[model samples]
Target: MTATPDIVPPTEVRMAEIVFPNHTNHMGTLFGGQALAWMDKAAFLAAARYSRRAVVTARSDQVDFKLPISVGQMVETVGRIVEVGRSSMKVEVELIAEDLHTGERKLCTRGHFVMIALDENHHPTAVPALPADIAGP
Candidate 1:
């Protein structure tokens, strides 16, 4: 009898970007749209990594901007798969801002994104179930 090797997939993805003048708004803080774009990209990468398949954003939910991220600050975005279905995954993404000189960090924004795995034909495709040990609510 042949045994199937257990393969654990990645559940999280992190990306970093430095806030620049062009990325800010008139108030000198990061723009809401730019933040959303970054969060979506992080979610896409996390879902793709977990599923090992092409993925697309299905929706974004409850994005809250808690703090202002000023220009010159470093932003670190993290995405983690929280829920998984046959063809979709819910990823929780957070953006943290850190002052380069002071090293002070704070959570600036948080949101949840739903991503759907897609096949070559652009139809929904099944994804592997998350490991029980790391599965989220």
Candidate 2:
């Protein structure tokens, strides 16, 4: 039998946004809702890239706000697929805040999102399995 080609894991997705006055709350920090929105967008992008299909957020879990991100800070969100099921992928996302002037960075928020791939009819569809090497025992 011929050997199967190795399946490469999808690359992690990273997106950056600058915190502006409009994005902050009265306390001058990033709004919790805005942070969650950004995190969900990152998760969507990562899942779409991995499946090469349309995806939607099924649920979000374990969201934690660890720090306050002040206005004028750069926010970087990173998303990676942590687990895979028949039609769903679990994406772990982290939002980091960086001070432009001081070059200091802190993880402001983290969460897990479940995304499901969709077919042409917008129904759930099967996704590729994680590679043996990437899916640890």
Candidate 3:
């Protein structure tokens, strides 16, 4: 039998955005809603990369804001597929806030998102199965 493919988390997807005044709340911290939106986008990218098809957010698991991301910080989001099913993928996304000047990074938030692959007709479809051997936590 042919060997199955393998995937890893670190190389799955990487997304980054600079936090601006508009993305923050009155307290000068990144808005929770904005962080969720960014995480969703990162998850979508990871799902699409894993399945090689169009995907949509099905549901999101618990999200925790560990720390505040202040304005002018660089928000880096990393996403990878943690679980794969027939048509759905569970992706975990972590947000890191970096001090633009000092290059210090800290975990700001983390979340898990589920995405469903879609066919051309806009209906849910099967996605490629994960290989038996893969790397990543």
Output the number of the TM-score-best candidate.
Answer: 1
Residue clash pairs of candidate 2: none
Lowest-sum lDDT 10-residue window in model 2: 128-137
TM-score of each: 0.94, 0.92, 0.88
Residues 86-134 of candidate 3: C-alpha lDDT, one tens digit per residue: 8999898999999989999999899999999999998989987665565
Runs in model 3 deviating more than 4 A are 1-11, 135-137
Please report, in order, the local distance difference test score of every candidate based on alpha carbons: 0.97, 0.94, 0.88
lDDT of 1 by residue, 2-102 (tens): 99997799899999999999999999999999999999999999999999999999999999999999999999999999999999999999999999999
- Give model 3 RMSD, 1 decimal: 3.7
Q: Is candidate 2 or candidate 3 better by lDDT?
A: 2
Per-model clash counts, in order, read 0, 0, 0
Candidate 2 displacement at residue 128 in angstroms = 0.8
Worst 10 residues of 3 by lDDT: 128-137
Candidate 1 vs candidate 2: which has greater lDDT? Answer: 1
Better of 1 and 3 by lDDT: 1
Q: What's the CA RMSD for each of the models? A: 2.2, 3.1, 3.7
Indicate whether candidate 2 or candidate 3 has the larger TM-score: 2
Candidate 2 structure quality by residue, lDDT tens digits, 26-106 = 999999999999999999999999999999999999999999999999999999998899999999999999999989999
